[model samples]
Target: MDLSIINQIRSAFENLPDYRKPGNNLKYAVEDAALSAFAVFFTQSPSFLDYQQRMQKLHNRNNAQSIFGVHQIPSTSQIGNLLDPIAPETLFPVLAEMGDRLYTQGYLEPFISIGDTLLVALDGTDSFSSEKISCPCCTQQTLKNGPTLYRHTLVTPVIVAPGQSRVLPLPPEFVRVQDGVDKQDCELAAAKRWLTTWGAHYAPRGITVLGDDLYCHQPFCEAVRAQHMDFLLVCKPDSHALLYEWVTDFERTGEVQTIEKSRWNGKQRMTERYRYLNQVPLRNSDDALMVNWCEVTILNAKQQVVYRNAWASSHTLDEHNVVEIVAAGRARWKIENENNNVLKNHGYHFEHNFAHGKQHLSNFLATLNLLAFLAHTSLEWLDEAYHAVQTAAPSRRTFFENLRTLLQFIPFDHWQHLMQFMLYGENLLPRKT
Candidate 1:
């Protein structure tokens, strides 16, 4: 049972329900259309299949067949038409399978932080928007002085760690209209659904959920606690008046404690001050949830404050581990910088409308795009050759550019051959099955 990654993904697509009538346009399999769309996102080349089709005509060989096992490349419109009716949930099993492989291989060990706990950050980002293009699933909002804008958004959760560049993404929950619900979908509701769907699976692994101040309220925090999971959410002074009032009272009694450390940044010394209080009521009520509060302030040698923020945590804060807890809380930003920003700015073209079918085309294509990113991240952790070449290149865009250029001119037997050629200018050996 030597199943390669590509083969495993192919099997997942093979099980997609076919919506077409029997004996109608049987030239392309559903797997072919789905994998064809995936190939474009994988190689970061929109015309990837077109180049392969040309190569198949000229040289009787194409990387689509050899590498991706795409026998017959479908047109872009054909790909959209084939995938429009298919729900995005069908592809989730593939993500789970890949993540399982990574965990089994012990590649996910570095992602654990705060003593045997994994940090999962949650946030929402708009996927597509237009004043003209619209779908039944698109949530629309009317401007005060302009036309109504319809857009698609998703609540994305990713596994993050302090000082780690890579963040492993979990399956996203799309924010759209629900049957029998009069109001439009919201991020908080979608987040709760996501937790309910994935909580049991991840709870046993000792997980802590992280989010912005918007998620610091009782209903959502209680939802997280209901799943037997922990949380470390940003808490602002203005928003959490009751909690700050308790802290102010603690300060009056001198119960609050402070710890400061100095570090040299090759030019000057900087100061990091930490202040914390344990077991404070989060709101003004008898049944309010009690949580630990911590804040970090950075100062320069001139006693000038540089940055400051605070958070509420389910885990008790102490003098020994307050710094680590604060660092873990700060790592929440990686969900924005490392994951969302790279997806949008670094060659993924996340907001670009690749296919906006009337039904599920936009979301399905977006899922494929995200899956491509997850697959690449897995390779970075598991494949030595991939990591080597990726490090050898100047940037991420440059690495993909090299791959597309080589794939355009050369016909390789498989992914290993392509990688070896890129590394050594020749196929050194066959990939182990």
Candidate 2:
């Protein structure tokens, strides 16, 4: 086993405060419970702890204790009850540490996009909803003539690049009930809170925030600018009528011009049309922030429009770097396709409701799952052994399925041994089956 990496995973959970009464000695340590909760996500199994319990009974050891540093396995209810009260922020520092590790290991070098900036995509995703299931942290909206819908949402940010498919995730910010507020929490509000909490964390890094049309508004753009961060927000003509109106006026006045270029994407050649204005007012208000506006359209060989989008930015739009800027902006889909979709649909089963409690359970479990993904992605990027195992499997789903099957048949003394068997087809695996 890579003790160093395993120790890092163990330490992330160790950082959470134990909210349980100390005088009431518990069967499992708080770190153990948190790690046990995390193990479910790590293995992509719903009954990870149940199998580990059986493993302990049969072999006197289990992967939870061996690989996860969990002294005692936690029941599903116990894990939820234990983790429900701990704020998700309690585990955020570990994400920064993980990023730092990746940076030091040179794993993040390929993720740097144009302008030496890390493209961070921001979007909110609904975690769960149930008419009967409601928690203090749940957001509720009453239907027009039906039962109120209780749901949970989180704003996820992930670092992406133009061509690199691997996206490194940042610690998420949950949209939950807030103090001293009568109105329901919203995605934009949650993003601001996210920026306030982690802006300084990103201030020193070369970051360019990417988002949908909803984030192209003045206040949101201003907040990102205030953080000393750049932005490439989707600016639709309909939504930014005043801005587009300015574009029309500038074109008539000959102040607005376009820079067109043709580039080949593999065998297919396409024309890129770029229309930009260096300085423009964002809104009709006199005090509106001055910003750069640009639009890009791609046409194929037949001259049929293939793709088109407009954006507002803090950088000047010019022919020298328009393609790179567009690529960075277009990477916003990575947050949805590579990050959120993988979490929800692919194999993480993120929205499957591991367990929900009255307080922070739903969001907390989601956080743990994301951390697990970060850990695995880190390994895939940094560890040759894990990479070798991945190559041996036909697909990611097969790799995880084989891992869970191996865990059930026998207990591996270390994580490395399991990978060794998978990679070499060695007889080192004990046969409890």
Candidate 3:
């Protein structure tokens, strides 16, 4: 991890307006509290601060202060108290700035296609939920027993590509009850807010938003067009009666095009059939947007279709690029598998309730976790020292295990020292500075 990045993050938190009573002088620094919270996620350990605070007592130094730039360690309750009032939106700039750096360094180029258009997959996942615990921001729904269950859902937009395993994410939008709105909040509403607020961040660079059938409708597509961006959304036939009716009608006219090929998948011969239609009306209305639709099916030797999907695209569908478009569309799974699954099942503990303050603590903690994940991803991909450690580790779990182990037992003056210890397979001492 870059020290400069942590410095910038600390600065961002420090610069956030305290919003506390001007007459009151807080004992703990707000930025330090925030950084301590981030350190919890960064280390993937809720007890990270307790252990580091012990180290500070014994050695007069702590990993949280040294590695993440925390000047004062705050209790978990204090961390939530200091961060509750600051909206998660305050952290969006950090995500954007980090992405700009990644792009400038050409780390994001592999995700580019269709003339600088990066594929941004959008989806919602549950961040936290409890049947008994609830906050003002939590979305409430009556359960089968007539008891209300409160939950938080987050809409994540990530930069992804078909062949790439690594995915980079933008700041997520939380789906929750707002101050002035009486309507029941939902993921689509959060997504709309995400696109309107952050869409400009991506439009200048070219973006093609990817989502499921929930976003394939006319209004959402119009929203994408309004931002001067494009969309490649999953279009399920069951939901689009008129659109499929048009396709069925076009089938009678022999206007639908198809391509077939056979390939070996090591175990069986797979036959892929791709079908496409260009300039099809998205709805039956006279003013329907003319979208390009493509569908693909993969059949096994048993002649059973093993995989099937369709996408409605803003780009023109043609023989030359339809396969590429479909491949990119299929990559939407990375948002679920590579991003959400990692956060939940890996080490980040997305569903765990680290904090649930009265106001913004839940969302703020989630954003901090995302920022830490982003930092680690950048290190994994862009830092040579980190890459050396990654190459030597047996798996991602083991890599983070080694990091946490070192942070607990050892002290290093530089991040690369830990990398060197792992890479060289030797017991090492902290470098003399």
RMSD values for the candidates in order, in angstroms, are 2.6, 2.8, 2.1
Candidate 2 Cα outliers beyond 4 Å, as residue runs: 22-25, 263-269, 426-433
| lDDT (10s digit) by residue, model 3, range 1-433 | 5666777787788887687787686888888888898888988888888888888888898778777878889888888888999888999899878888898889888999754699999999998999988888899889998888899999999999988999999988999987788998999889999989988877898999999999898989999999999999999999878888888889899999999989999999999999999888888798999999999999999999999999999999888888889998999999999999999999999889987888888888899989988988887776777776676778989988888888887766666555677666633334446
TM-score between model 3 and native:
0.96
Residue-by-residue lDDT tens digits, candidate 1, 1-433: 0127788889898898889998788778889999889989999999899999999999999998888889899888888888999988888778877887887788888888875789999999988999999999899989888899999899889999998999888889899998999989989889999999889888888899999999998889999999999999999999999999999999999999899999998877899999999999888888899999999999888989999999999998899989999999999999999999988999888889998999999999899988998989988877778887888888888889999999998998889877887677423345456
lDDT of 1 at 49: 92
Global local distance difference test of model 2? 0.84
Per-residue lDDT tens digits for candidate 2, residues 1-433, read 3566678878777777778886775886778888888888888988778888998998899888777778878777777778888887887888778877887778877888767877889999988887889899999988888999898899998998888878999988888889999988989999988888889988687888999998989999889988989988888988888898889999999988788889898978899888888788888898988888888899998899999998888877777887788878888999999999999987798788778887888888888889888888888877777877776677889888888888776788788777767766533345556
Ranking according to lDDT, highest score first: 1, 3, 2
* Steric clash pairs (candidate 1): none
Candidate 1 Cα misplacement greater than 4 A, ranges: 1-3, 426-433
Each prediction's whole-model lDDT (CA): 0.89, 0.84, 0.87
